[model samples]
Target: MGPITSDQNAYAYSIYHLILYQKMLNNQFDTLGKLLTVTEKQVTGPIYHGLFSTAILTAHNFLTEFDKYFKADSGAAKEKIVLVKQALKPVIKEIKKWKDLENFRDHVLAHNFRNKHTGYTSVFSDSTFLRYDIPQTVSDLAILIQCIDFIGRAIQRYFQAEYDSVHTLIVQQRSGQSKKSMTVEELEQYLNQLNQEVRPAIQELDNKYGIEVKGGAGETLDHDRR
Candidate 1:
């Protein structure tokens, strides 16, 4: 294996979090869609709002990390927020769709207090709480998903270029004795190592959180939860 630099580590970390959050957001969407079939607003509304805010914040964090570590000037990476606004210029429409959601994030979800025009009737009054009334329909969620997907694609494009360069370097290195594919025995040993590492972690999750990793396409439920 090649030595990983700080920049590569940062990029890997950002990609991991981005994919994990996207999976979580997808699962949330599945649950919300099912719940909406039975009871739309009463069950799905709060969940949608919460997960929507989380998804947006997750995407923002991904972009922040991407710009900070991946797109930074190699000589002057200490520069903060470098090239981020310029990078985002192509996605302005998607960003505009998030304006009200951003407001909800700032006022109700993230801060839980007043923004410029929210969370207060009067500063001195006892009635200072405001309702979370952002209208998040399925269509709205679809738009949000589109924006997140766009960001993911953009990040992928940036990484693909880097990957191509790395691939060329690896190809050049392949003639060396140290850079060959693993033997069958080596692959088996690797699988055994992975199984040893992961099985315990999966069991721990099952024990502590009632979660499971069923090794197939079908979903299984814990009878206790039902």
Candidate 2:
């Protein structure tokens, strides 16, 4: 890529397996450098959650604004949740903590308040702000920073997985490898089967208190939901 924008686009698209996957990975992670300045400018202390919220909101908004490119509604904020689900599906199963994320997403979507943070009593009443405790020391702030980092990382990986899924399908189709390589139709069908295979959890999502989840900044729309 010749410039920052080109590099990121290449990276995002690449991660998605969309034509130039290696090109972007070849550039390494530069966006994190940018986030440093952003987080620095962000309000410090308990309100610092605003920084994370802003980051998440920015991603949500990006998805909404670029909906046409997403192959879904321009403001399909729920896609964020879906992407997160796609990315976390593996780890959740490994840790045997599947419900945690689904519940967290649901909590944030509505105005529920069950975040596990020490003082995170208030949940996403609206994607506008969140509640948290001000870290007392470097280590304290570091912990929050780590969590924020993970959140940011997740957004990217989720986007990468979805983008790759779509891009690869197209590649397969063009190459006539779709019949052999996994097609998007097949992948989705498999994912759907996986969902259907889940005998207890997804259904329990509705039966339990926290089931449905959502996130994203719906610019041309609500810009708040996701």
Candidate 3:
């Protein structure tokens, strides 16, 4: 999974062990995006070395953009990463306990591979597969679910800020309107920009390569919640 090719060489390239694990982790999350339709997903670039590192990165992102979003106000949002890091801190602490479990399981499987007389069917073999397979899959899913949380929270934050900006624009217009919601003009204007200016250049990804640029612009974008 790392620069090294296989588990057989993992110990030999122990320096890159973390890199290898992260590579495998990224693959697992990529699979999650393909399998699930959920918006709240955690898809970081790779497996992290530990929870401490992750917490640090979260803090970094939060502090870097503090004033722009939070602006020293409680009502304003800093970012959803602020919330998600809080959600993840406890879970990541627990995962640290299981850090070596993956390697231990891999060692067991490698041992089995080395001693393999031949491939055969048996209840014992089937049961052993359940043992490691279940836990490995669970870890992968847990991580992916966390990724979902991270992404979903960030999107919510974006929605809030974007909403605030648009609402401010509407107020500045001071149009005599009964409702305080997005005008159809807003939707048409936004969509026209997306469909024409952006689409033409990104058509390969937008039209052919199967990239969805819509970013879950769901019904909430329609109503002005102010």
Backbone clashes (count) for model 2: 6
The best-first sequence of candidates by lDDT reads 1, 2, 3
Q: List the residue pairs that clash in candidate 3.
A: 22-47, 40-148, 41-147, 41-148, 42-147, 42-148
Worst 10 residues of 1 by lDDT: 216-225
- How far is each candidate from the true structure, as Cα RMSD in Å? 11.6, 19.7, 20.5
TM-score of each: 0.44, 0.23, 0.24
Model 2: per-residue Cα lDDT over 62-160, one tens digit each = 323333332333234346645754764553233222123233343452333444442455544433222322232333333333443444456555565
Q: Candidate 3's residue-wise lDDT over 82-186, tens digit each?
A: 564465565445444434333433343335322132253332444543343222333455553454345334434444434344445456668767677669999
After superposition, which runs of candidate 1 have C-alpha atoms over 4 Å from their true positions? 7-12, 35-46, 66-70, 74-92, 100-103, 111-135, 153-226
Candidate 2's TM-score reads 0.23
For 107-196, candidate 1 gives per-residue lDDT tens digits of 544554334464343412443222433335655555565555665555545454444445555567776757678999999899777776
Best by lDDT: 1
In TM-score terms, which candidate is top? 1
lDDT of each: 0.52, 0.40, 0.39
